[model samples]
Target: MSPLLLVVAAAGGVGAGLRYLVDRLVTPAAGARFPVGILIVNVSGSFALGVLTGLGAAVAPELSLALGAGLLGGYTTFSTVSVETVLLAERRRWRDAALNLFGTLALTAVAAGLGLLLGSAAA
Candidate 1:
């Protein structure tokens, strides 16, 4: 395997482990009513990816790929979010479903923008 692929694979493992730990830490208190764990993961991953993208111009390609394409890619779970939202809608929790859909989009976007700004400033 190529060096970059090895780096990405290792980082992906770390990212997946981190996601599992974060979900375990955050999910139980909220119960199964909503996907709070996934929301947090997605939003945080968005911001992290934004930072990585913003820093790309100033950083090495390998670092950016390892973190952005590998770590954040492994960490974020839009599929889970989508599935949970569908489940919520099926259960007639329209408000919760809408909140999950819009809230994740809005928040992750804002977080990514902020991360970009911060990363740009740092660079």
Candidate 2:
């Protein structure tokens, strides 16, 4: 494998481990219905990805790919969020489902944009 690919592979493992750790730590407090774990990771991932993108011009392409495409990509859980939302709706928790869907969308967008601005300023 290419050196860059190896780096991304390692980063992906790290990201996945971190995701699991964060979920384990936060899920109980987030409650069983809300799925705040996925929400947190997705938003955080978006922010991290935004920072990488904002620093794209100033940073190495390989570093960006490893963290953005590999790390954050693994850390984020869109599929799980979708499944959880669907399950919530199926279980008649319409409010929680809607909140999860809209909340994740709104928060992640804001986080990404904020990260971009901050990262650009820092760069």
Candidate 3:
């Protein structure tokens, strides 16, 4: 495999592990009504996504992927996000579940796009 691919692969594994650890640490306090894990991951991921994009824009193009994709890729947990939403909906927590589902999709897209725009603009 290409070395870049290998780097991404390694980043993915590390990101997944860190995400799991973070969820375990934060979920209990977040409570049953609110999916603290999804919220934490989503919001923090948003902030980090913004920072990564801003940094890339103000610094270098390469910084975007290295930080955005490498760091944020692992930091952000889509699977968990999906599962949370599904479980919520299944359990009849329509409000919370919908928020997780639609909110994440809309926000993450905007964040990534903004990041890319910022990164490219910086370049």
Candidate 4:
């Protein structure tokens, strides 16, 4: 394997591990009514992606690869989010499911914007 791919793989491993730990830690406290763990992960990952993309434009491309492609790519849980949404709908929690779907979109958009704003503001 190439050296660059190795770094990426390591970053992905770390990101996945971190995500699992965080989800486990947060879910028990928040309960089943809300999939708060995945929500937090997705939103945070969105924000980080934004920050990295903004930074890539402002600075180095390599940084974006490390932080955005490596970290956020592994960290985000699109599959899990989709599955959970489906489960909610299957259980006839259509309102909750719809809210989750829309809410994730809205919140991720806001978070990405916020990340860009914050990144641009920083030195």
Q: Best candidate, lDDT-wise?
A: 1
Q: Summarize candidate 4's per-residue lDDT along 8-65 as a digit string, tens digits.
A: 7778887888788878888999998879898999899999887776665675666567
lDDT for 39 (candidate 3)? 61
Please report the TM-score between candidate 2 and the true structure. Answer: 0.94
TM-scores for all predictions: 0.93, 0.94, 0.71, 0.91
**How many clashes would you count in candidate 1?**
0
Give a tens-digit lDDT track for model 3, residues 44-82: 676667756556446565555655677668878777788
Q: Against the unseen true structure, what C-alpha lDDT does each candidate score?
A: 0.90, 0.88, 0.72, 0.83
> Which runs of model 4 end up more than 4 angstroms from their true locations?
57-59
lDDT of 1 by residue, 29-84 (tens): 88978889989999999998888787757988888899888888889888888998
Evaluated at residue 54, the lDDT of candidate 3 is: 57
Q: Is candidate 3 or candidate 4 better by lDDT?
A: 4
lDDT of 1 at 76: 87
Write the candidate numbers in order of decreasing TM-score: 2, 1, 4, 3
- What is the alpha-carbon lDDT for the whole of candidate 2? 0.88
lDDT ranking, high to low: 1, 2, 4, 3
Candidate 3 least-lDDT 10 residues: 54-63
| Shift of residue 59 alpha carbon in model 1, Å | 1.8
User: What are the RMSD figures for all models against the true structure?
Assistant: 1.2, 1.1, 3.4, 1.5
